[model samples]
Target: MKRFFTALALIPSAAFAHVGDHSHVAATHLLTEPDHLGVIGVVIVIALGAWLWRRGRS
Candidate 1:
């Protein structure tokens, strides 16, 4: 959990790039947009649940 939060805090630092005179958007959008960030959060929760399920099965 600590590592996950740390990565989230640092990801924005590398999501940007300058293109000619404009800023290119890709990963940065995920951090900047609420809807996109929400989707990511949902995915993370689903993934964590799956991991726990598999571990319990074993």
Candidate 2:
């Protein structure tokens, strides 16, 4: 659907938006790394899928 595509399109921008010189012991690796970004993509997809699933149930 159009809404799904819209959310997909926004994923990359939203992923990078979290990067703003914030230091953390939790995530030692840099966010700009390809592997880190890929992990973020997977997490985003999972989160979006969960959200859509819950929304549809309600």
Question: Highest TM-score: which candidate?
Answer: 1
Candidate 1 lDDT over residue span 23-47, tens digit each? 5657776587766566577668856
- What are the lDDT figures for the candidates, one per model? 0.62, 0.68
Question: In angstroms, how far off is 50's CA in candidate 1?
Answer: 0.4
Span of ten consecutive residues with least summed lDDT in model 2: 17-26
| Stretches of candidate 2 exceeding 4 Å from the true structure | 1-29
- Provide the global lDDT of candidate 2 against the true structure: 0.68
TM-score of candidate 1 on Cα atoms, chains taken together: 0.53
**What is model 2's C-alpha RMSD?**
8.4
Model 2 per-residue lDDT at 8? 67
Cα displacement (Å) at residue 20, model 2? 22
**Which candidate leads the pack in lDDT?**
2
Off by over 4 Å in 1: 1-24
Writing each residue's lDDT as its tens digit, candidate 2 over 1-58 gives 5676677677675456455555543554656667677777887887788789879999
lDDT of 1: 0.62
